[model samples]
Each structure stands twice: as C-alpha cells, then as structure tokens.
Target chain A: MNPEKVNLEQKLSRFDEHWSPKVVGELNGQHVKLVKLLGEFVWHHHDEEDELFLVVGGRFRMEYRDREEWIEPGEFVVVPRGVEHRPVAEEEAHVMLFEPASTVNTGSAGGGMTVADLDRI
Target chain B: MNPEKVNLEQKLSRFDEHWSPKVVGELNGQHVKLVKLLGEFVWHHHDEEDELFLVVGGRFRMEYRDREEWIEPGEFVVVPRGVEHRPVAEEEAHVMLFEPASTVNTGSAGGGMTVADLDRI
Candidate 1:
C-alpha cells in the first residue's frame, strides 16, 4: 500500500475560505480536517461525538458556558459530546479538527455556516 | 465544564525519553500521544488499529515494505491497519501519534521497545 504524506501547510495553502473545512486525512472512523477560522462561530454542541480542536497556527478563543479558553499554537482542546461551545478567532487562524466522519460543522445549530459537503484538500 | 487546554510543546517538554509515548489527550476511543523519536524504530504493524503520525518538529522517514516516505514538520502519514512500517529519524524528532488506546508501541513485532503502559503527560 502506498502511504501518502499529507503536508498540513501545503494543504492549508490550497484554501483561503474561512470556516470551510477541508479533509486532509482519515483514520479509523474519524476525519482529520483543516479549517481557517476567523471571527465568531455559532454556539453548538455535538450530541454524540466529541470534537478535537488543535491550533496549527495563530490563536483562538474557545467560549464555553462558564469561561473562555485560549488555544494557541501547539495547543489542543477536546470538547466532549453535548458540551455547548463556540470558537472565536480575532484573526485568521489555522486549525485542525479531528472528529467522526459524520460530524457536521454546525452541529445542532444548522445555518449558513453549515457545510453539508466538505471539500478535500 | 472546564475545558483544559493541552499544550503539545509543554507536554513534550515534560518528557525526553524516545519511543515511549506519553498521552496528551483523548478523543472518542483514541489516544493522542506524543513521542520523541531518534534513530530507527523496530519494524512493526498494528493488526486491529490504524496509526496516525504527525510530525510536530524535525523530520522522519517512514520505511514501508516497498518504499520510504519522508515526513517533515507539519506533515502526517497514516499507516493503515496491518501494514508493516518502521519510522527512522536521523535527528531528534517530535511527533504526535493518534491511535486506539490499546495500540501497542511495537505492534506485533514486540520487543524491548513495547510499552504496555503509557504515561500521561
């Protein structure tokens, strides 16, 4: 089997759209996605799947019901299932999200930010 | 719920042992581990779980049965289940491994490098 190496920086350079996640790799039942986040995202929660957010570049603030956590480069946070949270980035931030393949971008709060069909970069 | 942020660099700084994986975070049924790799690892393959290797710093070469793939910083390679592979790093490399919690470090070709109990950093 030919194991292809996925360069995150190169894959990230292929896209400039914010909030739209592009699949970079897959393992087991999970999909590794790269997204450029800016401004604020909708407050939502995954009812059945946990989401892993890793900051590849820049910084983002993860706002929960109680407090806000700043995720800087080389930092990661795991939002467990059913936990309401929102991500806000003051500037363009490169992020890597690891979750189940079936996970939606908007979670329960589907809106314009919802990406039903994700692009692979 | 308090979402604690896991800093990869800070966690990696807590340990310097090579090949021994330290758990940094957990998502679903998988464990996100950080390991420092130097020199060559033993040839091995996981029978029931696929392994995701992301190079956090430096570079490493993945030697497969037929060819070798160089993984540099910000690059990742997923070794599918049951595929034979050996990771070789000429210099010290920082890497993050994502796989099932039960994944053995040495896979089927277990030897002294096999870590039955992983430490959480």
Candidate 2:
C-alpha cells in the first residue's frame, strides 16, 4: 500500500460531521483521527485502551467523574483506560485523537454517540 | 500516576537538543515524542514498526531509497516499516513523532543520533 500523507488543514476539509472521527493516518497498530466537536459528548470510556485527545485548534473541556480540566490548542490529555469522561466544547473545536486501531469513539457505550464504523480520509 | 497533560509549548521549552527526542506522552504501548531537528539525520529504519513524523512547526524532507517527500507544518508523513530513510531540514524544525514505546529514535542504528534513553517530560 502507498503510504498516506495528510495535512491537518486538508483533513479538516474532508468531513463535516461533529463528534464522529475521520481517520487520518495509522502508525503501528494505532489510528490517528480528527474530529470537529461542539457542545458535549457522552460520558464513556474504552475498557481496554487509553485515548489521547490533542487539541489542534480551539478550546476543549473534559469532565471526568470527579474532576474537570480545560485544554487549549497545542495541549493534549490522555483519558486512561476504563475512565469515564465527557468532552465538551464551548464552540467548534478541531482536535486529533489517538487510540488503538480498533477503538470506537464512544467505546463500550454504543449509543447515538457511537460512530458505527471508522471512516478513512 | 497522575496522567500527564502537556502542551507542546511546555514540552518544547524543557529540551533544547537537536535530533534527540524527548518523550512527551504515551498511549496504549506507544510513545509520543518531540524533537527539534536541523541539518540531517542518518539513513535508518525500524525493522518492526512504522514511524510517524508530524511537522509541528517547520518544513521537513524525508529521502527514502527510491523516493522522497516534503512535509510542512500541519502536515504529516508516515514512513513504513523497514524503509530506509533520512530526514533533513534546512532550518531548525520542530516535530512530534509517534512510534512503539520501545522503538528508538535511530531504530537499529546505534549512534549519537540514537538518544541513550527516552526522556520523559
């Protein structure tokens, strides 16, 4: 397979769905995804893998069961495996997420928030 | 472990070495590292894993055995497993790299470019 090369701006132009992640690249057995988010995401956690949320642009807030924190552009937070957390944004936020190749955005929640299949960009 | 939350700006400030990558974060069993590079890096390849080069702040050029590519800020290129390649930048460039937790910066090449150990920020 020819290796895929993508730019943040280029990937951002390919999709408009909020909360749903579009796969940008893959390294080893992990996937890199970009998501445009607004409002709030359901509280969920991946039972077997850690999730990384890297804010590419705009502000992001992640609220955990016991604490909440704010992340800005260039900052990132890793939600440990099996930790329930919700992500919310005051406005449209562009972010990159890193997780295992088979991880679901909503993890085991399987709700409206769960994206059925991963879209490759 | 209080899951570490680091901004790219904060991590960049803690190290000034060129070519040597400082580990910023880890997800699953992989590590995320930041490196400031100038001039050229030796031709090398990881026999067991693919490597990701995300240009965080400058331009990068990677030359492979038969092909080459240029990447700019906000852009990323993945060098596939076992592809011998060399990375070079005319001016100082800042980038973030993703690889397996134990993969060295220089892969199997044990040289000065091979950082002794991953430095956690």
Candidate 3:
C-alpha cells in the first residue's frame, strides 16, 4: 500500500455526521477513529476490551454509574470493560478513540446510531 | 485511579531526551508514546509487530529498502514487520508512536539510545 498521512483536520472534513466515527489510522489490529459529537450518547459498555476516549477539541463529559468526569481538550479517559457509561458534549467536540477493530460503538445494542463500516479517512 | 487528561504540550514538558520515548498512555497491552528526535536512528525492525510513527512537529524522513518518504507535521507512517528502515530528522522533530508495551526502542539490538523504562508523562 502507498504511504498515507492522516491529518486531523483533513479527516474531519470527510464526515459530517455527528457521533459517527471515521477511521483515521490502524495500528496492528486496532483502529484509531475521529468523531465529532454534539449530544448525548447512549449508555453502553464493552464486554471484552477497554475503550480510550481522547478529547481533541472542546470539552466532553462521561458519566459512569459510580462517578462522572469531565475531559477537556488534550485529555483522555479509559473506560474499563463492562463499566456502564455515557458520553455527553454540550457543544461540538472532536474526539479520538482507540479500540479493538471488532468493537462496536454501541456494543450489542445496535441501532441507527451504530456506524455501519469504518471508512478510511 | 483519578481521572486525568494528557495534553500534548504538558506531556512533552516532562521529558527532554531526544529519541527516547515517554509513555503517555496505555490501552490493553499497547503503549502510546511521545518522542522528540533529531539526527538519525539506527536501522532496526520489529520481528513480531508493526511500528507507527506520527509526526507531531518539524520535518522527518524515513528510508526503506524500496523507497524513502518525507514526513511533515500532522503526517504519519507505518513500518510493517521485519522491514528494515532508518528514521532521520534534519532538525528536532516531535512524534507520537504506538506499539505493544513490550516493544523496545532498539528491539534486541540494545545498546545506547535504548530507553531504560517508560515513565508516565
């Protein structure tokens, strides 16, 4: 394959759907995605692998059953497996997520919000 | 553990060594690191895994057996397993790298330039 560079702004321009993730890069067997979120995400959890949420721009908040935390730009959070949580962004926020390639954003609770396939950005 | 954010500038301030990677985050069995480089790196390759190099600042270059590529800020490159390549930076450059936590900077050809341990940033 030809060498490619994934610039943040360039990737953001390809997708306009909020909360929908665009695959930016893949390392080993994991996928790195960029998403723009402006509302609340459903409460869900992964059963087998941990999820990383890195705030690239704006502010985001994630609430777990036991606690809630705010993530500012340049910050990140690791949501452990099976820990129920929801992500909320008051304003538009840009995020970078790292997870296993098999992971689904909404887990087994598939719905309209679930992104069908990862498109290379 | 307390919730924390990893701002790129904040992480870079914690270390000053060029080419020595500092662990900025960990997910599953992999490590995310930030490295600053100038000059040339010893030619090496990982036997079991691929390596990712994301340029965060300045210009960088890499030479593979078949071709050489120039990487500018906001760009990245992936070196497939067992591919011999050398990374060179004309001026000081900052980069983000992702690999399995067990990966050594110099792999088994350890000597000088090998970082002792990954310190949290």
Q: Is candidate 1 or candidate 3 better by DockQ?
A: 1
User: What is the Cα-based lDDT of residue B98 in candidate 3?
Assistant: 78
Tens-digit per-residue lDDT, B1-121, candidate 2:
3355678988898988899898898888998899998999998888998898888887978888777788888888888888888899989899998888878788877787788677888
Error of 1 at B67 (Å): 0.6
lDDT per residue as tens, model 1, B25-53: 88889999999999999999999998999
Range of the 10 consecutive residues with the lowest summed lDDT in candidate 3 chain A: A1-10
Q: Pick the candidate with the highest lDDT.
A: 1
Better of 1 and 3 by TM-score: 1
Write down the RMSD of all candidates, one decimal each. Answer: 0.9, 1.4, 2.3
- lDDT winner between 2 and 3, please give it: 2
Q: Return the TM-score for each candidate structure.
A: 0.98, 0.96, 0.88
Provide all candidates' interface root-mean-square deviations. Answer: 0.7, 1.6, 2.4
Q: Stretches of candidate 3 above 4 Å error?
A: B1-3
What's the true lDDT of residue B108 in model 3?
51
Steric clashes per prediction: 0, 0, 0
Once model 1 is optimally superposed onto the true structure by TM-score, how far is the C-alpha of residue A68 displaced, in angstroms?
Answer: 0.2
Candidate 1 CAPRI grade: high
Q: Tell me the TM-score of model 2.
A: 0.96
